[model samples]
Target: MREFSEDYLRRTRRGMWDDSREALAPLALESRSRILDVGCGTGELSRVLAAESPSGAEVVGCDADSALLEVAADCVPVVAGDAYELPFPDDAFDLVVCQALLINLPDPEAALAEFARVSSDLVAAVEPNNAAVSVDSSVDAEGDLERRARRAYLDGVETDVALGADARAAFEATPLEVLETRRYDHVRTVEPPYDEGAVVAARRKATGAGLADDRETMLSGGLTEGEYDDLRSEWRQMGRDVVEQMEAREYEREETVPFFVTVGHV
Candidate 1:
């Protein structure tokens, strides 16, 4: 498993989670309240929560990876801590917020229970809806291996610490009362400087993973002339399409893809 670097976290935090922050904003306690943000990559949400909290409220962000925490620490008071065993006393916080973290955990339920143990107030979480993938044919067409690979990678400690669809179920078992559920839709159109680097980085990483056949060959800089030409051509075309769409503002009016958001209170 490849542990995510702080650089990776910083790069991702800016672009990902278009929906989670919006869904969490309303449920967040007043600024004066103490809140803890688990898996606070780059402190994006932590900054928002801190600025929005009642004048005196404190926001604390924690992640296990010190590399990421270093970047996050600049924006918020960050601690190196584990979600399963929080370094806080019972009822230590007024609110606990975790987003895109459940699926990444080995024990989602235990993590939530730990949150409940530390906070006297509320526990809010957001996770990808695995069940909802059926609504999008393109993403759904990624096939079994790609799907399994994605799942495995997200669940790995070195990748996205995602907790997929089971986050809500895990939260339901705890003592918190369900407060609200909202769906926020987000549509990402990748192109140019924003996506090119990421795409290349991903392909390089895949190549390093030693995938079988042409895929591995392609990554390892050993693809045949035809294979290289075909793949690169397709990639270039896709990039051009994205750039064109972005230029035409075609995505502005497009409906955001649906992602579930649930809020609960103690």
Candidate 2:
């Protein structure tokens, strides 16, 4: 499984459930008595689940990372455990769900099986279709460059990072009965009155820090060293353009990541 830093989780999941949560309707949170959020990371979705569910509902977060669990503990009850082997008895929860978790696992089906074992009623996954991501930016080249970089990353990544609506296949492989799938677009926007994080992101782009972090994955995906250099060169140039636009307070960008909420009955 892949690991993520607390900062990465926070940045990517910022404002996720803030706008609307109609897609979460399938989870039927109001009546849920016990909910377990697998691979909860910093507990963004765990917090949301807790808030949306009935006041007395028990919401627990489980993760392999102890450090992340420490952070998540601030929000809800947390346990350090692997996704495939949860540290709980069978039928421990009424609803077992994960967000952006299955995409990083080599065997999502296996994990779903475990989720079914633990959940007496529901199993849900909230995964993104990375390939379907759309970006619009004031900097004309930014959108195209982002797509190119994403394509390379997806091609090279080991896990099925693009597992979105297709999560039904994995659920079908388990004992759980397939339920409904809902599409939710998580939009991240950067416009005037840029926040501190936005400014720092521009700086990271200027230094190609983000691309550098994915350099190994891009290379493993068949991107040659020379090709990577050329791409990074262009990427840095684009970043500089973004920085310039930010300086003028004219930078605007909206990135839409389509997430599929797949729910199943165990």
Candidate 3:
């Protein structure tokens, strides 16, 4: 499983579940008695599930990270557990769900089987199609460099990162039958009145302070050292331009990530 910090999880998942009610409606979660959210980190999705479900529904969150579970416990009932082996009885949940969990797993099909085993009614997966991400930035080089970097990162990923585009195959491998599929577009924007984190991130990019962290992964993914050096120089310049625009209060960027909500019935 992949490890994530509380800050990273919060930043990436911001505004994800805000407008996802339509995509989540097929499962009829309002009537569910027991809703289990596997691999729940920071309880973002679990909070939404709890709000959508009936008053008596037990919307629980489970994760392998104790620290994250501790944070999640404040929002919902959280348990320390792994997705491959949930610490619950068979047919223990009327609905089993996970948000952005399967794409990072080594064997998503096996996890889906476990989800099916624990769910008696519906199983849902909310995952992103990383390959189809689109970016529109005020700085042209920023968009281009981001595409190049994303390509390198995708190549270096050992797991099936594009699983959201073809998740039906995983369901076919399991005992559950596919019931519905819905598409959700998550749009992340950085504009005027930038937050403290965005300002800090732009400054880091301008100084190339964060480029070194991904250097090893890019090198292994066919990005030569010389090419990386050149990209860093350009990235720094673009970041500087962004800073200038920010000073003028004219910086804006929008990135759209397509996600799929696949619902399966046992």
Candidate 4:
């Protein structure tokens, strides 16, 4: 499984559940007695689950990364465990859910089966369709360039990162019965009066550091060395353009990632 840093999770998941949570209706969190947030990195969704559920409801986060669990421990009780072999007993939670977890797992079906084993009532997954993501930017080339890079990354990724609405299949393959699926768009924006994180991101782009991190993956996806170098050069130039625009407070970017909430009954 892939691991993420705390800063990465925080930046990516910022303001996730802040706007509206109508898509979470299928989880029926209000009446849930116990909820388990599997693969709960930094407890983003876990915190949401706790706030939405009943006052006395138990919202426990479980992750293999002890460091992340330590951070999550601040909001709710946490357990150090793997997704395939959860540490809890059968029927330990009324609702078992994971956010942005299935896309990274090699065998999401196996994980779903395990989730059903621990949940007596419902199991849910909030996964993104990376292929369907949309980017709008003040810089014309930024959107297209991002799409190209995203395509290469998706091709190179071993797991099904684009498994959004199709998560129903995984749930149906398990003993659980498919309930419903809803779509939620997680939008992240960058505009005038740039924050510290946005400034750092622009700097990384100017240096091609972001693309450098994915160099191995792009190569695995069949990008030749020369092609990769050319792309990186262009990416850095675009980053420079972004930095220039930011200096004038003319830089603005909006990225929308489509996430599907699939709920199933045990």
Candidate 5:
């Protein structure tokens, strides 16, 4: 599985629930008594789940990473456990769910089966479709380079990165009855008066360190060393151009990551 820090989780999940309540309405979270959030990470979704859950509702966050559990503990009752083997009895939860978890796993169906085993009511997954991502930038080259790099990255992802769009089909094959599926576009923007993180990211790109750091992940996806080097070269050039634009206070970018919420009756 991919390792993530609290900061990374927070950044990626920013504003996820801002206008996403409608998509989640079918879950009927308020009526759920025992809610188990698997692979909770930093508890971004768990926090929202905690809020949506009614009084006395038990919303417990669970994950395999002990480190992440520490962070999640601050938001809700957190248990360190594996997704394949939840540390609970059958039909223990009224609702069982995971966010951005399936794409990282090699066998999501097996995990869904486990979710079915633990839940008497509902099972759901929120996953991203990397192929459906869109990038818009003030600089034409920046957008083009991003698309190029993203294409290679998507092509090489070892897991089911495109699982978000196909999650319903996968869930339908399980014992659970499919209830609802909704797509939410998560927009992350980079605009003027760039913050410390944005500046640092720009610097990393200009130095080609960002692409270099992804060498192994890209290789795992099927990118050749030569292809990687070429990508880095072009990426670095684009980054330099971005720096120039930044100096002119003319840099802006918006990236959209399409996510799917698939809910099933267990």
Candidate 6:
């Protein structure tokens, strides 16, 4: 419930399905295919598919978040809709593709049931590898409270209220036959200047909102040289947790692989 907006997440955070665009190419028809991209945040994936389909496919992306739908509309025909109860008629799409969706839904099975209900042929799904939930908290710090907290925050239901590992289980429960599932470890390098200053400012504002006394000291002197080392440690560990938290794909030959893709059909 404390997560940023969908646009903010796109700008500030690396996605769990960055490679999903290419992964989904094979599942769709050449052209004239009507594809429904459920949970199509920002419409990045839907637009790509629509463009690539030589047959001139119509890719419609849907999301419950209207704010994101505004942004997604720019990329494709975005609808203000929900995955659980799609507004279209039965078997409305030749293919239904949902990448990195199952992992974030509280009722992924229900959503998948909807996917099955609407999809006439295939249902392609991408999800995080539950076995890939590894962490490298090798920081020589005093305690791993930060690491534990970070993991707890991510491993729990997302701030946006999505499922976690249970998403995969829910997908498996679907009546859809498992056509193909691949575990991909990809990482999107997130450089600094990542609006950390804004975070500092927000924290300060929050401290002020609560009328905390140590706001100035905490923002200024509290970030001491020694504290920076701790902060750096926290940052790195938190970054890893973020990748896991987002079900982010792992980069080839990277230290960690946080994202994966899975596709199936009924």
**Global lDDT scores for all candidate models:** 0.60, 0.93, 0.87, 0.91, 0.85, 0.57
Model 1 residue 71 distance off true place after TM-score fit, in angstroms: 0.9
Identify the leading candidate in terms of lDDT: 2
The residue-by-residue lDDT of candidate 2 on 1-266, one tens digit each, is: 98999999998876888899897899999889999999999999999998898656889999999999999999999999999999999999999999999999999999999999999999999999988999999999999999999999998988998899699888888888988988999999999999999999998888899999999999999999999998899889999999999999999999999999999998
Q: Model 5 over residues 190-234: C-alpha lDDT tens digits?
A: 889998777877888899986776678778777788988888998
Per-residue alpha-carbon lDDT of candidate 1 for residues 137-204, written as tens digits (9 for 90 to 100): 12222233333333433332332233343455667887777776666655544333445554553354
The TM-score leader among the candidates is 2
lDDT of 3: 0.87
35 in model 3: Cα distance from truth in Å? Answer: 0.9
1 against 6, candidate with superior lDDT = 1
Cα lDDT tens digits for candidate 4, 131-184:
899999998889999998998877788999889869998888888899898888
What is the TM-score ranking, best to worst?
2, 4, 3, 5, 1, 6
Candidate 4 displacement at residue 96 in angstroms: 0.4
Using Cα atoms with residue i matched to residue i, what is each candidate's TM-score against the true structure?
0.66, 0.98, 0.95, 0.97, 0.92, 0.64
Candidate 4 minimal-lDDT segment of 10 residues = 48-57
RMSD of each: 7.0, 0.8, 1.5, 1.0, 1.8, 9.3
Off by over 4 Å in 3: none
Worst 10 residues of 3 by lDDT: 14-23
By summed lDDT, which 10 consecutive residues of candidate 5 come out lowest?
14-23
Error of 2 at 68 (Å): 0.6
lDDT, model 1, position 209 = 32
lDDT, model 2: 0.93
Tens-place lDDT per residue, model 3, 50-115, is 888765699999999999889889989988998999999999999999988999999999999999
Better of 1 and 5 by lDDT: 5
Tens-digit per-residue lDDT, 19-59, candidate 6 = 44465554755843799988777776677677678888889
Give stretches of model 6 more than 4 Å off: 1-4, 12-22, 29-32, 129-147, 155-169, 190-255
